[model samples]
Target: MKPGIFKPLKLKPFRSLFGAQLFSDLGNWLDFIALQVIVAYHWGLDETAIASVIIVLGLPWVIIGPFASVFVDRLPKKAVMIVCLLLRIVFVGGLFYAPNLYILLLFVFLKGTVSALYDPARQSAIRMVVPDSMLPEAVTLSQLSVNTMKIAAPALGGGIIAVLGPKSPFLFEAAGFVVSIIFLLFLPSLTSFEESDNRMAETSTVKTSFWKEFSEGIKHIFHAPLLRISIILSSAAFFIIFLYDGLFIFIAKQIGFNEGNFGLLISAVGAGSVAGSLLLGQWTGWNRKPVHLMSSSAILSGTFIVAVGLGGLGFLNFPPLVWIIGACLLGLLGAGESVPYGYVLQSETPKQMMGRVSAAAMSLQTFSMLIAPAAGALLAKQLGASFVMIGAGLATTLLGSTMLMIIWKKSGSFQPIRGKQLDG
Candidate 1:
């Protein structure tokens, strides 16, 4: 690899890809914060309505995302990435001119659809460039960027919304997309177009049925004891853990903080997540102990979330200082779950098939994200947000422990210690 942009990364191609990924993700963060503010203030949307919009945005990935892997494999991966980026640039740009709620929702849906297609290509591209031994570190470092970006971007969005109008953030988001496109164009070629063309030509003739590839991906995951258990546990845990989306504002309301303080509250969780992600990145040897680490983290995270709900309800709760600790603990759980999962996916799967396998895992997370808002909103409305949050936390803790026990029985190992390598 040439030295400069490629120094920390083992491969030049991966360095370019990483740069593009970072800028694109930054745009996504800005869009999310800006749009939610529009809904809350301009449209006067209540919690349920806001949650409903989020559910709609998430639904397509669960419904249409599986097919992306098969299609991504057929196309030149870099070309596919560029195409998706262009599509997002066009679609998301619509928000700047209109900025109405209906138009905003449409743009949100378009962005989600674009992401569903784009994600598979990005996953496959990593395998194309990076050496296998470096995957864990790469995955960890990538997540560290994501967590760090998460910490700063939302606050920036909040500040922009406060200073300028709502549309200011959209303009910034558009600028980020443009920057990503420029980075992608500057990327040095990996496989020659001719080589990729020849590689496709020499592979076995295309199967007649499209779903055959999708079925194979699903079957491979189910056959792997660790992968299957991990997916199930993570999905269930996320469903419960994400109640914070609904609970954050409610708790803020309960504690008598104004709308601007909402940014600070979110920042607290982001701070904790950033710390956890950095710790995991620096300590790359924990890949084998994923099951044990995930279980313990989930248990602790859920316990803290339950405490937060109790604090809100004033049920034997301490002062606001204690609540901050609870928030940080919840963030730790978030980081632990995410970092290990990324390492497992990058390390365990064959490079060529990573797109499908990753899509399969992500499909579950998409559904979990979809269900979370609805479930959280309904429970918050009917019973009470506090009760719903407590219940969710308890449920997540139990689910993680159960999944760990089952996986341990099958593999004779519960922790994430390394063992066999799949044929790439």
Candidate 2:
């Protein structure tokens, strides 16, 4: 039987880690929502400018995170986490007084860089503390924190911005960092717990270059047509979604809402995500015919996007509450696609190659994040946000339908992937 979710909370080390993780999660939302508000409402920046800020914030994760993850294995996890938290506090502080957008972007980039390290270190730390058997429960508890807080944090952040001014969320985020660091201090010096001991160590082994390691991952994917195609499709979906992902502020405006209600739009998504997670966690049908599941989810997501487009074009005059409901459905559909894709990824890849496969996949998504936002925003500018949103919806629907048919026709083309080539 699976352990109860709170079972891990009984342990001292786990509690500290949980608390720190909680604060950090909240900080991320506060930072994100605050920055969007500052750019869209306060400074009144255009769509392209808003997209630029989003790209700059994400660049470090794309460029630095992949390379930095290799070092997480070498470093003391606790120490790295603490140092990153300190840097985050400083970086968020810079955002507080960043007189203009350029400086704000710089600080956001720096903050994002350390975040790349901190996340992996925190995950490593969890493995050090939690018993292997309760790993599932511990992870569930952690995700509970993430999803629940995700629902709360955006609303809390918007409330802070509404009353305390846009920069105030940065201050709260800094304080959150401080609190996280304090709890993080309680974690034992888990130095080299998962260490490469002398007995098992291969002294003659020369470390391969990052590119070489990455190439190995690429080879694994390409060798497995199912995994490769699935990853490419997943990345394509992400690219399409993110094209208008950062434009929720403008979307809200078009739908007859202000900055205050923007958080409602996002919070509803979080609620939907939580529901979807719970549903997928229980449902067994997702494992079989996952392509159909994802395609259906994508179809619904496109429908929701079209609804938003209609709202933007004044064709579908949804009330504020109805719009929020639509956002929730979109979120639910998103979680639907992601959970099944993860299952496919796990089933397709060998255990030893999991990290590299994930990293390679992340690189694709990051590239999408870097390029799609600017392109979307530029299109939103030239042709107007409404028409772009409509085109985006139509395109997503087309992509999903086309992929589904292709998979149905060529199911035999994707063979069972694992064998000597994968093992070698």
Candidate 3:
């Protein structure tokens, strides 16, 4: 973060929202690890089942979220967020009592649905209290909590699962939600904040049908060149990004690394992610270029992944610790993925359409993910994980570098006039 990053923290509503996100995201990562344990180790399920969990996580957002996000715009952002958090508490608790894989899938799906709505509303809420000039800093700070938790929660969740049992992590997840709710309770009405901004309909209402709102949002993104291009590049980046993501265990094994130590590799990725995010936030050159941040991220991340694959193939004589370092670099690049897209979505979209537009972008990313895991796993099985990583990495680099060139090819078209909010 930059020296003035703390400026956003001066606002009490933003402070409350930040605190809530910190706890909420921490518990999310903890639940992620705990579920892996319960599904793969405790239940002794097959690889298909484990992958199914990943797919289920994205299913709601991809399939139902874009349309459902219409309601997010129609409701009070704070109320929607609070309700979603409360529902998530119940959904996380449901994991403990789930009797079978099918039941477990249902609970995960429900939780994802709530998150789909909660996330966009949260984005809208941040835009509510934080000034546009400070929006980038606020978002970076919010995501810092997520990346920070990514490093700590995996280790902590693993320890809790081993010591207290697989179900113990859920208790912590619930605690996180409770704390978030406590903080959210302090978020004052932002009616004045909305008024000062001069964006119309600062109040939530239902003048149009759900289908109309949904179509308007989709049209808005498709109509705006920068938003359209940035979103497509971000989504496509993730599609390639995930090609080797779920196959890490196999990648580790093929590279002669122990599978049990996979958590360390993940933690390394988290640390790299935190570092990368902070570095970019402070990097004046790429300060608010969403496309550049994302494009450069894809190219660099691919190169690192390719190196890891080569190491796995005995083409490079790197030790396991070095491999972990490589994974960290990849994780650092992962930080670039969301932050840039988020900045664009918040800064470019109308305040009224923030919920729908963010959801649309997220849904596109999720749509790519819905198939990437299965594809990656199958590819790893057939061609060996190292070869799969190499292929995926090459593709990712090409996509990143190509998209950056195409967008910048046009000069004034990509630059935005900052004074007015995008009605689109």
Candidate 4:
């Protein structure tokens, strides 16, 4: 039987790591909102300037992720995580006094660089801290933490900004990092986990050059059929889905939603994500066929996206609440898709190479984010916003179905990844 959502908290190390991750992720959302408020409301900057800030924040993940993952693999993950948090605390704290946009951008870049290093290390550490069987539960809880913050942070940040001013959220963000660091200190050392895993020792002593090691990580990913296909499908889904990121506001306006109602529309996704993650956490059977679950959920999410797009275009003149219901359904399927795929990545990868593999996966997602908005904007300009959203939905549905067919043909059945199933 599946354990409850709180089952993983029984492990002290996981508890500590999860707590640290919660605070850190909450701080990230807080800082994101604060930055947007500072740029748009406080400084009266245009959308172009705001976009530049976001691009700078994400650039390191695209450019430095693979290279940074090399060091993540070599270093002590706990120490690396601590250092990343400390650096973020400093950089975001500086945002409080960043007299101008130039200084703010510099701090954002530095924080992004630190985050690029932090992410792979943290992902690697999760495998070390928890038993393999609990990986899906651990990932689910971690995602729940993220989605919880997604639902709460904007409102919290907005409240703080309203009461205390734009710079106040930065102070809270810095404090969150401090709390995260304190929680991280309670976790067992990464060295202890590494010493226990002889495979990790064997891999670490391979004595390859830095570039060779990095190249091996890339080659390993592509040569593994499951990893390659899963990563590509997941990345493509994200690329298509995010094409509506910037156009959501326009869609909301077309649907006659006020700013307050628009917040509800966005929050509906977070609410559904929380619900889905919790539901998945309590259900143990999902591990049996993660690929199938992922593909199926992607298709469902795409259908919901199409429904919302069509509604916005006046094809289905439902009430605004109905549209919000569709958004919730989209969010629910999104969680269903992401959680299983994350479990696949964690459970399938060797512990020794987890950092590099996770980094490669993250880099692909980051690249998608980098391009999706621009593509969405250009396409919306030419084809109309609603049509662009419809196109994204169609692309997602097609991609998911195609990936499912490929998987079915290769295995004759949707078999779980057992011993050496993905060996090249």
Candidate 5:
């Protein structure tokens, strides 16, 4: 259901932002795979060590998330993004000559920390530039590009590595970051929301403590019923699905897949995601968000993951075709699940507070995911990959259902905003 061509990327600021983001994302995929390969083959790292490198990359997102939101709100959105892109260029460039694992890890940590600030700023920028009517389509287009890169980038990285060497990907990534920085440099400063009257007054008259601002954001999320439900549901979803993050490689290995097939399996999900984002973009007339979320939550959470577990049951026995089908099915489920999530976030939060609220939501989501990879890895090691998948699927389904029930009782329907509200 995607447009024949990209729906004209009309807004100048959005056009520039999107262009910058696309190149950066592409380069990031390249760098990540290249770095991992360098660590594994060139440096002779074990699986655990390679995983440690990945963990270090994600650590900044976890540790810096709350504080990042505060800074994102205070800084000029475009400036924040440009600075982050430039920092990445420098950090990634350092790896070209040094090319050492410990140094690379340090760079990754800094990149991740900076990314935590940039992401919120970018999202807030989107809210500022895109008109409300076009927001959904904008989100779809952005997601499509991300998913497409995810599906295609690794293969491209692999091909590059095969031809040039592991270091080639880092150099390519560095160049991509530079290109992103170039695109960002042209972005206008006007594409950002101004601080609300209350916030501006406080900033002007009273110098508030950083912790106070941070805690206020946290309290606002918990005290606001809609945000409360959104965070709760999102966190639950993250926790339940975290198991899959943990067990993916293990599952592929159990089912007689090599690294190539594992990459394909991940790509299958991206393919499905692309398909789902397209569908959501085309079909946009939901009156009842809560009901839709509640119903879909159980169905989406349990169905494909259960299928994954079911398919993996024959891991010791199944043919290649069956494995392929299972991967496709899982992909379909992943695609279906993502569309409703964006609407839930957009409709549930106030526009002015979106940056901090979004950060809070993401922070909780990360807190949930923090345990998923390790737990999934441990479960796969102890029980069996299939069992972990099944357990995760069921846990996610149950949690979603429980959250949905709470929303339904409190709100009477799944729709976060009324149809009349959307019309005006």
Candidate 6:
């Protein structure tokens, strides 16, 4: 039997944690818009300067994520989360008084550093709170919350900025951290076997070096074939899909869409993401192999992306409504890949190494973000935005096909770890 969408919410700790994360996610999007306005409009920065700001914000995750996860594993996950949130609130609040672009960039980098700790700790904490059987639903619902915010927060931030001021969104974001901290305070303490058993073993026996512990995480990921394949495919998919973010404006213009209608494209993706997550949340078990499911979704998503490109090139000749529908279909298929991919990571990873594994996975995604925009922009300049989109779609389709073939040849079936097998 399938679980209800609300099934994970029935767990008290998960319920509170989910609520807190929802507020934080909303504040993040709000702050994202506000910062863009401050950097581009208020400060009169050019495109290069704005891109530099984004690079600074993302650099910490790529550089510091693995080391940060070591602390997450050593400390109590809840304690790390609360402290990280408090630090984030301070850095976000500092954004209000940032008198110059450099100062603002400094604060954004600090906030990103803190978030590095917060994210892995939160993922590890979720494992502690819910039974392994419920993780897929929990992850799906969590993704749903994020997508819902993605759909709404931009509009909310715009309204707040218009009514209040440019700095209002940062203030709002700071207040959200306070609320998130309050919720964290009500949660119980959580400790993994590594934290408890390993700590005692380290104290009484020989202590493991920090480098050794960190290296273990890297080794674990690469050594596990299934985990390794998923990470690579996920990173490739992210790189391909995010190319659109850099080229969307040009693509929209080619399709005869004004700036206002461009927003509709983003909204369509978010709406489809919500629907896809909701569907996955209720459909208890996915009886198919994880790799097959993931690759198939990628294929479908890439197909839609190709369709969107063809529409822009007048090959498809899609009307505005049809174009929007294609974008929604792209998003829907994207969720089909992403949600299951997340489940594969969480379920396959040992509880003790959850922080490290999650951090590593996140770093890969961040690295893709750090490069995708620039690559897309350069390609769009030479080949045109329509061709860039088509190229990305074709690349994604090729990647999925290759992975599907490899997985089928190496392992006829890949079963996700559940219950007791998960702990192994």
Best by lDDT: 4
TM-score of each: 0.89, 0.76, 0.93, 0.95, 0.87, 0.95
What count of clashes does model 2 give?
0
Assess candidate 1 and give its lDDT.
0.72
Selected candidate, larger lDDT, 1 vs 6: 6
Q: Which tens-of-lDDT digit does each residue in 326-400 have in candidate 1?
A: 566677678888887786776666655667788888899888877777677778899798888788778877877
Query: Candidate 4 has what TM-score?
Result: 0.95
* Residue-by-residue lDDT tens digits, candidate 6, 150-183: 9899999999989998889998888888898888
Residue 224 deviation, candidate 2, in Å? 5.0
The digit string of per-residue lDDT tens for model 4 on 1-424 reads 4567788899998888999989888899999999998999899999998899888988999899888897788788999999999999889877888998999999999999999999888888887777767877998998899889999989999999999998999999999999999999998777977655423323445445567668867886776666677788788887887788899899888887898789999999899999899999998588877777888888777787787688779886878888888888888888888888788787777676778888988888889988898899999999999998888888888888888888888874334443653221
- RMSD of every candidate to native, in Å, equals 3.7, 4.7, 2.7, 2.5, 3.4, 2.2
Better of 3 and 4 by TM-score: 4
Off by over 4 Å in 2: 1-19, 37-49, 76-79, 97-100, 121-147, 162-165, 179-209, 223-227, 246-263, 284-292, 314-321, 342-356, 403-424
- Report the Cα lDDT for candidate 5: 0.69
The candidate with the higher TM-score, 5 or 6, is 6
lDDT of 5 by residue, 1-424 (tens): 3462245377788888888889888987887787788889989888877777777877777678777687677667888888888888787776666557778788788877777777777777776676666666676667767777887779899999999987888888878878888887877775334543125334543336566667767876666565466567667777777767767676677667887667767776677767766765676553245334434645664765766676678634677666676566655555444545554555555454556767777777877777677877877889888998888778767766777667668764333442333223
lDDT per residue for candidate 2 within 1-424, as digits (tens), equals: 2335467788888999999999999999889889989888989888666777777877776787767765654567778889999999989988888888899899988998888778766765665676544554565456656777788888799789889998899988988989999998998777545453111234344355545555666787888777776777788888888788766678779889887777788888888877775665555455556667778888778888988988888999978999888888887887677766665565565543444465556667778868887788789889877777877788778878877887889888665454433323
lDDT of each: 0.72, 0.75, 0.82, 0.83, 0.69, 0.82
After superposition, which runs of candidate 5 have C-alpha atoms over 4 Å from their true positions? 1-8, 195-198, 202-209, 253-260, 286-291, 294-298, 315-319, 412-424
Candidate 6 TM-score, C-alpha based: 0.95
How far residue 142's Cα lies from its native spot in candidate 6, in Å, is 1.2
- Pitting candidate 3 against candidate 5, the one with the higher TM-score is 3
For candidate 4, which ten residues in a row score worst on lDDT?
A: 415-424
Error of 5 at 190 (Å): 1.7
